[model samples]
Target: MLRVENLVRRFGGITATDNLSLDVARGELHAIIGPNGAGKTTLISQLTGQLLPNSGAIRFAGREITTMPSYKRSALGLARSFQITSLLTDFTALDNVALAVQAHDGHSFYFWGSARNEKHLREAARSALARVGLGHRADVVVSELSHGEQRELELAVALATKPQLLLLDEPMAGLGITESARMVKLLQELRQEVTIVLVEHDMDAVFALADRITVLVYGRVIASGAPSAIRQNEEVRRAYLGDQHAVTDHA
Candidate 1:
C-alpha cells in the first residue's frame, strides 16, 4: 500500500505536479492516465525518490518514504519499470535478471564467479523470467529480443526484486496489437501477485487491468474512480476520453 498526500513539484516557474493526492490499496492495480505534459512521470519520479517533492508526503507500507534515497526505496519493496527499455545490450536476458536478483540478495558486489554460475541467483532470476513468460528466452541476448520481449524483460527485472508495489510507465508504448494483448494478459496474471501503479496511454489495457483510474491534466488530478465511473464522468469526457471515444466510434 502507498499514500501520496498533497504532493507538489515544480521546475523553475512551471508546476509539474500540483498538490497531487492519491492512494494504492494493498494488492490493487491502480492506473494513472493523462495527456502529454500532464506530470504523470514527475509524480512517479517523486514517488520513487528519483526526485524530491517541493512539498507533501509519500508513505509506503505505513512508513514515510518521501525523503528516502532511490536505492533505499528499491530495497524497501518499491520497484519500477521505465517507459523506455533499460537493459544491457550485450548481456543475456538471464544475466540481466540475475544481476537484479543479486542486487536484491545483497551479493551484487561479488565479482569472481559469473552470475550465471550462482545457482541461487540463477534460480531466482529464472523464476522472475517465468513470471513474465520469458523463461524460454533466458539465454538470448537483449539485442536479439523483439520490442515486446524487451518489455517483458523489464517487468522480469522489476519482479526480481519481489516488490510489493510495481510502478510501470507505459509498458505498451511500442507494441503491436498482438504484443499489447500479450502484455495485458501478463499484467492481468501479475495483478493477483503484486500491487501495481500503471501509467499508460493504452486505454483498453488500462481499463482491462486497472481496478481504478486516476486522470491527470495540467499537472492536477481531474478524476479518479473505477472503470465504469471514469467512463461516465463528464469531466473525464471533456478533459481526456472524448477524443478516445471519437476514435473508438470511427474504428
Candidate 2:
C-alpha cells in the first residue's frame, strides 16, 4: 500500500534518512523501530508530505505522492497521528472528530459553525469515536480526558478521514500499563481493517502488533522481515536492540 524508494532527508551535514527504502503491503501492520536519532519521524514526515525528501520518491497505493502537499496526501487517504497529542483541548471529543470529518469533506474551518450542526457530520464523528472506544466520552471536553483517552482521541480524529493507510507515530508513548495494553488491543483489532505503518519506541508493542518489522539505524534499514527474524538479526541486535532480550515491557 505504501512504497518508499531511496528516501533521503538531510539537515546540513547530518543525514536524517540515508537512502532508506521499504514497502508496506495492503492490510498489513508494518512497524518501523529504531533508537533515538534514527530518523523514524523524519521518514514519516516525508511520507505524509509534511517534509519533502531531498531526493527520492514516495508512492501510496501505486501513485507517486513525493511532491503532493500534506493536505492533498491526506485527501488521498493517508492519515497520521502525532507522537505528541494534537487535539482541540477546548472542544468536546465529538467536536474534534466532527471537525476532522468536515475537513475530509473538503470544507474549511470557516464552515465549522454550520458543519457542527450537520447530522451526517455528527454521525460520522460519532462512528469514528466509537471505533476508537471513545464513544462514551464523545461529549466530554478533551482537556478532561485521561492521557490514554486523549491518545485514543487522536486516533479517532485520524480515523475520521477513513484512511486506507494509517501512519501511527508512537500511539503507546505516554500511557500507563493498563492504557498501553488497551491500545494494543485496539490496534490489533484495527489492523484487521486498514494498513498501518507504526513508528514506535515501544518494542513490546512493535513485536506484538507488527506483521513485519523494519529496523532503522542512522536512517537506513538494517533488517526487514517477520518479528522472529528481526529478533534474531545480528545487525538489528548490534545496532538497536543491544542486550535487551525481553521485548515485553508493559511497565
Candidate 3:
C-alpha cells in the first residue's frame, strides 16, 4: 500500500534519511524500529509530507505523493498520529474527533457551527471513538482525561479520517504497562481494519504486533524481515537491540 524509494533527506552535513527504501503491503502492520537518532521520525515526516525528502519518491496506493502537502495526502487516505498527543485539550473527545471528520469530509471546520452538533459528523466521530475504545469518554474534556485516554483519543482523531494506512509514531510513548497492554490489544484489532506503519521503541509491542520489522541505523535500513530473523540478526542486536533482547521474549 506504500512504497518509499531511495529516499534521502539531510540537515547541513548530517544525513538523516540516506537512500532509505521500504514497502508496506495492504492489510499488514509494518513496524519501523531503531534507536534514537536512527531517523525513524524523519522518515515518517517525509512520508506524511510534513518534511519533503531532499530526493527520492513516496507512493501510496499507486499514487505519487512525495511532495504532496499533508492535507492533500489526507484527502488521498493517508493519516498520521504523532508521538506526542495532538488534541484540543479544551474540547471534549467527541468534539476533537468531529472536527477531524469535518475537515476531512466537510472540508471546513466551520461548515456547521460546532462539528459535534452536526448529526452526520457526530455519528462518524462516535464510531471512531468507539473503535479506539473511547466511546464512553467522548463527552469528557481532553485535559480531564488520563494520559492513556489522551493517547487513545489521538488514535480516534486519526481514525476519524478513515485512513487506508495509519502511521502511528509511538502511540505508547507515555503509557504504563497496563495502558500499553490495552493499546497492544487495540492495535491488534485495528490492524485487521487498516494498513499500519508503526514507529515505536516498545519492543514487546513491536514484536507482538509487526508482520515485518525494519531496523534502521543512521538513517539506513540495517535489516528488514520477520521478528524472528531480526532477533537473530547479529548487526541488529549489536547496533540497536543491544541486549534489548526483549525481542526474543515478546511472543
TM-score of each: 0.95, 0.96, 0.96
Candidate 1, 1-251: lDDT as tens digits = 99999999999999999999998999999999999899998999998999999999999999999999998999999999998999998999999999998888777555835687889999999999998999999999999999999999999999999899999999999999999999999999999999999999998888888889999998899999888888878888888888555332211
Give the per-residue Cα lDDT of candidate 3 at 34.
96
> Over the stretch 1-251, how does candidate 3's per-residue lDDT look in tens digits?
99999999999999999999999999999999999999999999999999999999999999999999999999899999998888899989999999999999845654545785689999999999999899999999999999999999999999999899999999999899999999999999999999999999998899899999999999999999989889889999999887767345455
The parts of candidate 1 lying over 4 Å away from their true place are 110-113, 243-251
How many residue pairs clash (N, CA or C atoms closer than 3 angstroms) in each of the candidate models, in the order given? 0, 0, 0
* Candidate 2, pairs of clashing residues: none
Pick the winner on TM-score between candidates 1 and 2.
2
Please provide, for model 2 over 1-251, each residue's C-alpha lDDT reduced to its tens digit, 9 standing for 90 to 100.
Answer: 99999998999999999999999999999999999999999999998988988999999999999999999999999999998999999989999999999999987676557667999999999999999999999999999999999999999999999999999999999899999999999999999989999999988788889889999989989999988888878888888887674243333
lDDT per model vs. reference: 0.92, 0.92, 0.92
Instruction: Quote the lDDT for 86 in model 3.
Output: 86
